[model samples]
Target chain A: MSTNTTTRRLTMAQAISEATAQEMARDPRVFVMGEDVGKYGGIFSATTGLLDQFGPERVMDTPISETGFMGAALGAAAEGLRPISELMFVDFFGVCFDQIYNHIAKNHYMSGGACRYPLVITTGIGGGYNDAAQHSQCLYSIFAHVPGLKVVVPSNAYDAKGLMTTAIRDDNPVVFLYHKGIMGLSWMSYFEGSTNEVPEEQYTIPFGQARVVREGSDVTIVTLSQMVQKSVLAADRLAAEGISAEVLDLRTLVPLDRAAVLKSVQRTGRLLVADEDYLSFGLSGEIAALVAENLDTLRLKAPVRRLAVPDVPIPFSRPLEQFAIPQVDNIVASVRGLMTFKLD
Target chain B: MEATAEQLRWMYEKMIEIRDYEETMSRVYLEAKLPPKIQKGLAFDIGAGPVPGEMHLAAGQEPVAVGVCAHLRRDDTVVGAHRPHHFAIAKDVDLNAMTAEMFGKATGLGRGKGGHMHLFDPAVKFSCSGIVGAGAPQACGAALAAKKLGTDAVAIAFFGEGAANQGAFHEALNLAALWRLPVVFVVEDNKYGISVEKSASTAIASNADRAVAYGMPGVLVERNDALAVFTAAGEAVARARRGDGPTLIEVKTDRYFGHFQGDPETYRPKGEAKELRQHDPIPALGAVLRARGLLDDAADAALRARVSGRVQAAYDFGRNSPYPEPQDALLHVFAE
Candidate 1:
């Protein structure tokens, strides 16, 4: 929004690293720690060049002890230090989730406002590059299901930088999740528009703000993270076919942009949610329920449709993996199907 | 590390206070469990008493608390496991507030949100968790904060021997040592983790033995002897304050009650808990005081009466306190 700011095309990983670097330089309390974050520069390149700039004390390389480091981060946060802890992959939350859900998330409420836990847990998510069930996952829904945590998933470099900066500054515990497929790493395949022009100066994007990527009126495609790219492609294709489809990228899951979602649904009268998480009792269901709760009030058109991974582990095989993931084809088909749905 | 006559008397009085408080809680909880058809004047109902929910009484583990807390400062932090009443009282948390919390009153430490297991009294830097092996790592964080803020405040984590097997426990020990954080990890080896003996669960003979793996001193003390525990914990607390990192102290004690109130406890040998009461630290320490000429029968009787009166006042305040409105449950879920 600032015309005076300089812009550069940075990858999602670079944007995240720069955001963390700027925040660290700006606030003395902010520090980064995780497995291989210091010397190795992070496996997904999220913390590249941070150690050299901030030194070893501020940018720490922890042991392969998830529960230890995660709990330590929460402990440090409660003591008035802003700790940005990386959990490597969102799939590894199981090893140290007790600290995240019970301690870190519940500290403020449990203390009766006497203690503040300013912590950010940044982790990589999404399945691609043949990472099996263990590594590839988009479990933002799980963290969002928790009450105390703020969940954010960035679809592009610009939003990634902005949201990461905001998460670092926020007082509450935040779960900053990134899709491995959209990090713009050269070794792994990435979507075409994953990397985008990001402002060089530090900026903050407030949570609960939904970005309307492409505006249309026939059907609104609600999605986030890696699925945002596929939704955009699906909307483009739908537009070429004379169908106006709107694409809404939910940047943060916890403080959901309910107004944006309801407004889009009211204008389109058709809803299609594309998610990478599980289909049953998950984000998709929550969105459908949100629409269902307001169906009697909103202008009626069609039942809400959801496109998500079936309830199963992500297979190692590429064919099976792609089949389980919500691809552009699936989004396109789901949107087209909803366009033809008839209301009773 | 020697306790003077004053310190000994203070420890004895504190231990008596804890004993009286826990005994009264047990009595009130059982009275609530009685069938309503008994038609007693007591307004006790099943699961609807002033002090409702799970109550883990620490009637026999007074030495461990009295020993460790005797060395701690108000600025220091202490985290406890499921059975935390002894730690809270030992750390000098407000008894009236703690009682109100146990009674689910708004004036409680956690404002009634956290019953006994999740009590959080930031005023004393005290917190407890029902989760096994969860407090050690948090204690490390508190120590780290103390170090970073240039304060000599140390942290103490009180856990059961059973929680020593948890990964969080191992991680906490390793992290505390690797960074040389000021923390004292105290394992109250009550010999039973909710009806399972320490031998039946953990492979290690003593939870303190695991401290060697983390390059720290491990001390095992006589759990029933308050003076022995006091001496050992004093050294550990001194070592931590001297920037010597953490020390694992295993206090071998016994639980006079079930893991939780009303627990069937069929897993333990019959009469073991009742039999273990003979070694209870309160009477043991009182005997020591008597031998030292620090306390006579009249002095002991007067101390017991005073402690009993204080505990009764706390219980009356809790019983007279009002339960939070149903909607208050949704409050305190997030801080504004």
Candidate 2:
């Protein structure tokens, strides 16, 4: 439950900042470091006032060296310190990759299992704004290659707080990627247990659990991060046609809650995976592979469908970008196509 | 000396052992007894840059590794650039395993995943990146770990003058200075990177001068002299141990052979290889010790003979050691 009034309207950035602030007060080691995390609060103002409250030592403004600072966080974590690093924009993770690929995720197993880098790196990924090729792209697949790294993507204010706390508490190094689109919104009174409610203390949500935002049986829709909202909108559109859909929000990708997915699939013989990132080699493909490998008693009425961004660089034009990314219309059409289409 | 003459004698043994090991290994490779490790699919990535070689040696620059490693513990990290045989030996890595690694057998350090140039054994503080200047910043991170964790550990980055010209080398130095990390940038200037002479790659007269730009103290040393290396390293190591931050050491020297095995001496000044061999660090140290009355001719001969025996023993072990199981190669590649 988040701290909000009955009629409070909060943006996604405000929700994330609230979650971070409450956690820092909960644990002394929860510090923030990024390009503009300090005096700038955050480029999106997600870390505003954290600097003045926590002081320079706790809230740091790191150099533009992503690899250096990212490695510093991993190194610090190996020695019994917890670091929460921020990449001003997710696209910049390219500048420093040895930190994640070689250092953070590999530290535990490479040290002959003597160490655990409990580090959480937060970033804003994907496109919507006019931030062009170099600045816009969801590069999650690159990280999923690492063995000991957890991937967390939050869709709503409640899930953001819950998933981020899970990442912080996780023993392995985790990457918490926040989508830029799920940001400014006034829908605070909708999500259950979030009556703009406030808890006086801190808490955490368990990792690898899928939250069912909407429950139905005609079809099962699996989505993550910002794509969850798009799928929900699509499901609402599908409801008018007398078709019910079950929407499962996979808050964490690494420790995927296969049980939730299997149950939804068993109830609804059809499945569609909608994701903001490209479809191939992405989380949806991995899940589909799992389903094919398992082949439980769940018989499908139609073949599974995957709706995602096409395998092209994010274009800058608003119309083209809109056509490029998978919106609710795409999800609705893809699910509808699977629900009644030929199985051949 | 309160440091114990026995410990000092052990130190002497380590340096002698490292020097003779390289000299004998060079001959072994030259004789082609050490089979080339490259298979059809796997190529030997010489260094971070594209320097090709079946085997490389620290050659005439033995004391730099011997002296710096003398002050380092087995748990500490020693990051070496391309061609890092000296650092591999000084930290007391098993010579047999290292030789087999050069042979690209299943018994290699990375189980054939890493060839001679990619040698790394974190258990004994030995690791090298094929990339030139890549290890410097990582070493700074490793040292920062030690400092933040409140440990006495330090990181040693062994690179060449060419690597000091790399942006990573500069960035690593600037960051290490800003953080006051416990690291030592040990630049082994063999006066050339592959074939491009230092005259062309770098403008700073010496590797140590680059340290001044990062707000750190830089020192130059006669790398061919082992005692000079030991005494100089003792000061830098002591300062690091005192939490006084990093030191940049530019060891001015030359190699006795070409950069790698099988190179025609087209790059070197005529007769320079033979002339430089006279300054081989082990013999140079022996001469200094003998002049100082610390060693006698008989002791020097015995030291050389003992080193030769050790080299023979390592060769025998490597020659007989079994290759890694065909599938065991995949064991450490991924974490369970």
Candidate 3:
């Protein structure tokens, strides 16, 4: 890795669109379809200028039909085409879950290997802008729970581009979920940390690889997507207090980086899982289980703590929404609590 | 072309088989689910049945399946809604394996991973979903596959009237019409989607009318007769096979049983199921065959006996089959 390589700062959405445009240009089989993806340039600007370059045949705009386009993508993939289908929002999976889970995620297995769905389903996730219950959700855990889907959630623009390129090239179905709060949209205030220096050249990031944003020895804050930024901010604040907190951003959930998680937690001896998803039966619980299962070799100074959304619909009010979703303050407080813990 | 005598007889026999199979399932699904074997204060337990989980039996809706499937080949794909047995049986899915699947046996389709509503028989190009209106887009996909592969195989999606209101139905229609994919959408208007009536859930009286909005020919089968469904489905299938485009056909059928077997159906009116039973398509088709001098009393009895024996043997196979190993549930989640 040469640090002197030419790189330009790009937003998460621009990075994703660049990756998609590069892949489409590289591979004749790669095409994109979704609502407002063609002329309007995607609701989150993930496919900004593809229509003009690739034409309607490649970067087509689909009707507002998640089930229709998602199933069509699966079908097209089954017929030797790589399709990138956007679902506007992850919360809309309810209306078309049958196509997502029963077909897209299960067809290859159910067909006993006769059918392989090489497709990418991209959707926006997380709730920081108070889009209410139906419009905002970080439901990547639900997709990760399913068997056939590879779940990729990138934290920054650089990883977003690389991971998206990998997702589009994967033979199996992949659900690439991006947090709207981290996309750097002009309308919504985003974490500037998510916008990073991305190379103009095409690149790919392997799944199941976790990136340690900051190396520390006291506590490990394991998170992904939007929470990674918050965790980083909390780590920065905790660093001033001499807590020496570490932040681990899990890039993919299905092919999870179990080794990195265990190695980091093994080093720190204190673990705090910060997630934007629901509090129970989700990524937090899954991470906790991983630690508990490896307790025979790993030692811990304090119990593992979790900071996530409480079990409730994301409220429209900013105060309620902020209180529900894990914020920098919550992560800082959780890490502080872990620091003060004693083995009574 | 009109229906030949042989095709009519085949439709009648298939209808009888579907009716007998569904009736058998309705009875078997109630076993170990009633009073005294359940927890206190509960009228019935859906989970306590021999065939556990919710069972949506297509008893009086045999015509829609037989009619549409009669025009389908083994290579043609058929996607059915939650109440899917009739379509599965009509598509010639293995009766014993399908029955065993509902029984959650290791010998069943999907190896008991998919219960009654989620049967996947790729050999016959047949699959179904437990979700309402979920099959339309998938059917389009299958049709798109056939088109891309340069084959004449058509795809059929069988959903309910209530599903027409779902966004999937509209989107699939527009997509199929836009692509000119060889697919046929059949709506079995059985009056109710779970407890809500068609009049309550759907805005229009007929789902066929909605197809025209998507620039496709819409045909409505007013009667729940097999011959009527056969004629409409034959035309739609022919149009699809010719690569003309997609067509939507709505069959005014009857749901003999509740949405699921354990449903109390307090939302339905008194004598509604009884009224639907009076117009049972199984016997109605039999009369049609008799009027054409194609079936005598002896022939009808022989057909019924043959169908009943097959249905009973399937139930026996299901009942005798062993349950899937508990650990086996973890398998088949992904392809190796």
Candidate 4:
């Protein structure tokens, strides 16, 4: 932590672009390519100011050809160049998942280590600004489920910079998912806690380490990305009600920090997985299974609870979308419900 | 660029090898799939053979593979679509490993993770995907890699006519042209995308013409002739290697079998495949070789015997090879 008095608080978007700019300036092998990642400065502002800094060759604006550009990224990575290709939205993965999963993800393993794809696919995730079913999704769980690709979802500006640096430096293909709401975009309402005092120096955050955002003893909220922001708010409000809630942000899903999750739940004795991704067969179930499989050493105060988007598309209506996606109040209420159960 | 006698002889031998391999696979794929081998009342089962699961054979499309691959070098990359054995064999991929991969053996390419459609042999720089139109973009990527790495090695993507209509095909063409990549897109017009005729699926008559929209030259081989494909591919490969950018070549080819091993193919007109087989490119290429004094009866018999030996040995190796351990399925998910 930088204790300088002149510390500047940066948005998640600025921190991401800063990290990319630093890495690009340091490593000539690193470059950026995507639709509007150059002139438009990224739809979520993740690549803002990169085009002017690095010029056109390093910061490329691609045609609206996801498969072509994504495959080109894979090829470039295989040839020993590090490419940061941006998918405008995570929802659009369906159009080019063949290049993503079958090639970029599996090429290293399929080639028996003859080839390595060191690339970062950065895509905007989550729903809040009525981007409907097609545009609104936090499908990092889907990417995590597939083998060979690392999945990183950062909750705040500081973690975004560190994790994006790590993802770029990684020798494997990584999907760096940033929540649109947490990027501090002007058009959408955001959680203020997502803006943080990030250090200007380049740093790398190793994957599979969970951050204990707020220490609590009552119940633990296992979450990630935008839900981490909401969990912090829920934990703050729960303090007023004398219901302490520990918030654990799972920074990366592929190399998931099971020990951090189990240790937190061991002390709190209760678990509530708050996620913005879908409800079924997803992160919530995996977290619950992690706890359930370790019942010999752990005692549970209640059955594990989950707060996630119900198995429906993110609705266009505001109330319906909020109802489907887990919010701060939903996390607070879930914690309150967990407090009701007694071990005896 | 014209193919010399050596190139013509090599193309003829490879076409014969591919034809023999596909015919053998078609027969082997049906060994235990009939009514008696499966449960009662079922006429046929696709998943009950020695080579289980869906099998797509390229019996009548050997000319397309041999013609394109004849101009390729060991360093060049070839990306093939679903019906990929012809491309794999023509690209000099290990016959034993590829066959064993189809049989799901541990010694196979990809260690049996990828089957016939998804063979990835990095040694020969040959790979294929089961997804239609997926290979085009990947081929472009390989070409881009060569260009960036300062190599004259070109790449070729072999796809069916149906893939030409896919968004990936158009996108790859545009990207290849925009970047001036050293790639050649070869469309094997087998006339059907699993029963839907090209007339019904494609709006345009020839997919080669679609190349103009992406600012590339389009060449169409009006017949299923190996020499015609060789000449077109040689020119395209030379153009790509000389940094002339990408080209699109469409070969009017034939498919003598159903889409898959067990496909009823009731959608086809009666005797269409039989009628198409009368102009089989394998014998036609042999006739050309014979006319050019490149082949005699004794030489042709000797070549057939040699090709048959190799194909039979590959099939035997695949059949006799051991299946991978059950727990091995969890391996190769990631590189260490």
lDDT tens readout by residue for model 4, A1-344: 55663446999999999999999999988999899999899999999999999998788888999999998887677556888999999999999998998888887766545567889999999998888999999999899998899999999999999999999998999999999999998888899899999898888999999999999999999999999999998999999999999999999998899999999999989999999999999999999999999998799999899999999999999888878888888999899999999985
- Tens-digit lDDT track of model 2 for A114-167: 345677888887787767776778777667757667888877766676567767
Predicted complex 4: CAPRI docking category = acceptable
- Interface RMSD per candidate: 1.6, 4.3, 2.8, 2.0
Which stretch of 10 consecutive residues in model 4 chain A shows the poorest summed lDDT?
Answer: A107-116
Error of 1 at A23 (Å): 2.1
CAPRI verdict on model 2? Answer: incorrect
TM-score against native, each model: 0.96, 0.81, 0.83, 0.93
Residues A1-344 of candidate 1: C-alpha lDDT, one tens digit per residue? 68988999999999999999999999988999899999889999999999999998888888888998888887778777899999999999999999999988886776555667888999999896778899988889999998789999999999999999999998999999999999999788898687999999999999999999999999988999999999988888888899899999999997899989999999999999999998998999998889989877687577889999898888899999999988999988887787786886
What is candidate 4's lDDT per residue for B1-336, written digit by digit as tens? 777899999999999899999999989988988978798999998778778888999999988999899999999999898899999999999999889988888878877777788787777888888889988988887887788678999999999999998989999999999989999999999999999999999999999999899999999998998889988999999999999999999999999999998889999999999999999988888888888999999999999999999999999999999998988878766555
Model 2 per-residue lDDT tens digits across residues B1-336 = 122344355557777776677777666664422235443443333331212246667777777887777788876777787788878888877777777666555555565556676676757756666667777876776677677567888888899888887766777887788878888889988888888898988886787877788888998995566666777777887778789998999888778777777666587889998888766666665655666567887887887798778878877766666766777544543233
On the 0 to 100 scale, the lDDT of residue A10 in model 4 is 96
Candidate 3 CA-lDDT value: 0.89
**Model 1 TM-score relative to the real fold:** 0.96
Stronger candidate by TM-score (3 vs 4)? 4
User: What DockQ does every candidate get?
Assistant: 0.58, 0.21, 0.28, 0.44
Cα error of candidate 3 at position B300, Å: 5.6
lDDT of 3 by residue, B32-140 (tens): 8888888888888988877999989898899999998988899999988889999999999999988888888888887777788878787888888777887888888
Q: Rank the candidates by TM-score, best first.
A: 1, 4, 3, 2
Stretches of candidate 4 above 4 Å error?
A: A1-9, A25-28, A78-80, A106-115, A186-189, A199-201, A316-324
